[model samples]
Target: MSEERVGFFTDTSVCIGCKACEVACKEWNAIPEDGLSLTAMSYDNTQALGASTWRHVAFIEQPRPEGRTELPLAQGESTAQETPVGGDGELRWLMSSDVCKHCTHAACLDVCPTGSLFRTEFGTVVVQEDICNGCGYCVPACPYGVIEQRPHDGRAFKCTMCYDRLGAGREPACAKACPTESIQFGPLDELRERAALRVDQLHEAGVTDARLYGHDPDDGVGGDGAFFLLLDRPEVYGLPPDPVVTTRDLPAMWQHAGTAALSLLGGLAACFALTGRGRR
Candidate 1:
């Protein structure tokens, strides 16, 4: 579609712990290796999205909770038991490759001093490496903590939504390389519709915790370009359950500051008038 723009709709329910997306992201972006040492945690060595690691696949291992299904439990065990089936229980690993949300009301864009970070016609935010100048203002400005400054160059980096590839009418390297189609890239509108349908499907399949994150336009960050269908609370994925853009209150804050200044000036003037009368 000529008018359609590209975006990501990550279905975390079916993500199978493959790190192919992470590999594709690093390879395509030419991002530096953050070391291959195994983490004490699960299979995830790369913890999260940073300057060196643009796409991080999170691995969470947990016993599948009961009570959501109608199946009968084994002898002497009730379905509501939080304990595992065996002595340890059946373990399942949830995997999701995380990236920059490309938020609609991006705080990074709001706080950038240089014109390096700009919004494209596709409605994605990207930083021009040459123009960044290592200000580091965009780091904390992001509510999601998705962007970061590279250790070597100090310039900030995150997912660009593959601007160059999108311009060439191709999918992002991560999406293309994904084996299970967990990371699906397409027009945002269509993806949202599809995500809703998939959520319904999951609900029918007894996965009632299935919910969409960052899909609504009225959300805190005005929605995200790269949203997800998470299987649990957002915190399970290390995301803020309710993330408002950091600068959403800028106008109101400035107004309050102005009022406080006026109040202080008025108090000082009154003091001066009383002092002058006493001196006279």
Candidate 2:
């Protein structure tokens, strides 16, 4: 019997800029503290995800649309806010938790010399640290730049989607600790349906910018195991506008190289035969 494919559906609209998911992820995974210094770029302390930081919460402060006095609250509710106006306009915060996509066509898996990165029974990707061998081939191969090597050891690390917890039939700590239920986890198919419905709800409530990312199976990386519902452009959240698997053309390149090698060998053989006949 096979396990059903499970993944995360992160709804960024409802995220309150809380770092509970980040804290829960670190505690559950026993990940080391990467840093404590503030980057001075908003309220974000851990600027981005890295080897030691498996989860990162991004805080983007942008100018709100003019005359938009009310903001849509979670679960399709709207509330008027007495927000302060910046020099440009009224500032609104966009918060999102960033993690590994666990791509269906994982480029890290394709480039890893060792069998360190693998797909789990639940259809998520995981890296076995003990087997990594510090090769670092997977670092640049990742399209999302999710995988990273520890500075001291060079072994690659990234989100495993809590493989151990999944085996124990529990949700990931990030999702469990999300107070707003922004990070929902369940069967991939179910999550997709739920996300679509959420998008429709937001749209009907006048949030026209609501959209889904990495949800389509026909996407360039064959979709992501973990997807997101965003209220703005993906780039605003520091996500790539278009992501393709880094190793998508490897098979074709190898086939062309083989053909060239065969052609060269045939030419060499013919020359040798002519030389032999001439000698005779």
Candidate 3:
């Protein structure tokens, strides 16, 4: 029997802009260094998830919400007042750790001719580096742009949801290292329930903009193994608002192509038969 599906539910509201998850992921996975040079744009050094960086913490500075004087505490258990607002419209920082969505209808798996990407018993998508043929098809097949081809070797890579750790009955390194429990990992069902409650709490606390993303099983990508709770629009955090599996239309496309090919062949055969009859 297959194991229960497991995944991550990241709450952006409680994220403190720390990159502990990123560091733990790199140390546990032995990912190569992406870059060390500071971008000077923000505290975000890695900038985004890539072949070398499995977990990325984004730092977004925006104007503080109007009439909001206190920041909601983690889990909405309490509120913290005296939030420091900077000059020029009183900015508030939005921090979120981004990773692969691990879509239920994974387009990367569909486009991977080499069978590099596969779904685990836990219903999480993983990539076998040895099996990857460097075809680069899966790179563009991903809707969220999570997967990337390494420039040095041209092999695609993305988050595996810590498949090895799951097999060993341990939580992922990132979740274990998260200080604020922003990155929660568990059975998909339980996580969904907990996320719903958390959203409700935030809404009751007057954070009306709190919302869930990638949690619906009926979504365009059939929901995601890794979902998020965001404080603002998905686009504000560099995520697509509505992501559909790229290969969703493949079956119909292939059927149409087959019909057109058969029609052309039949017409040519009729033309040849009429010519032969005329010659006779």
Best by lDDT: 3
Candidate 1, residues 1-280, lDDT tens digits: the string is 3346558999987687789998888889888888866688878898888888888899988776664423212123333323324335656677788999999899999999998999987888999999999999999999999999987879999999888888898899999998878899999999999988888766655567889998988999999999999878899989899999999999999999999999999999999999999999
Better of 1 and 2 by lDDT: 2
Between prediction 2 and prediction 3, which has the larger TM-score? 3
User: Candidate 1: misplaced stretches above 4 Å?
Assistant: 1-5, 67-87, 265-280
- Give TM per candidate: 0.87, 0.93, 0.95
Best by TM-score: 3
Residue 152 in candidate 1, Cα distance off native in Å:
2.4
Q: For model 2, what is the alpha-carbon lDDT of residue 59?
A: 93
lDDT-based ranking: 3, 2, 1
For residues 136-190, could you state the per-residue lDDT of candidate 3 as single tens digits?
9998899999999899889988898888999999999999999999999999999
For all candidates in order, the CA lDDT equals: 0.84, 0.88, 0.90
Candidate 3: list runs displaced more than 4 Å.
Answer: 80-87
Model 3 pairs in collision: none
Per-residue lDDT over 25-143 for candidate 2, one digit per residue giving the tens place of the 0 to 100 score: 99999999887668887999998888988888999988875434454665645563545444564678888998999898999999888899888999999999999999888988988
Backbone clashes per model, in order?
0, 0, 0
Compared with the true structure, model 2 gives a TM-score of: 0.93
Q: Report the Cα lDDT for candidate 2.
A: 0.88
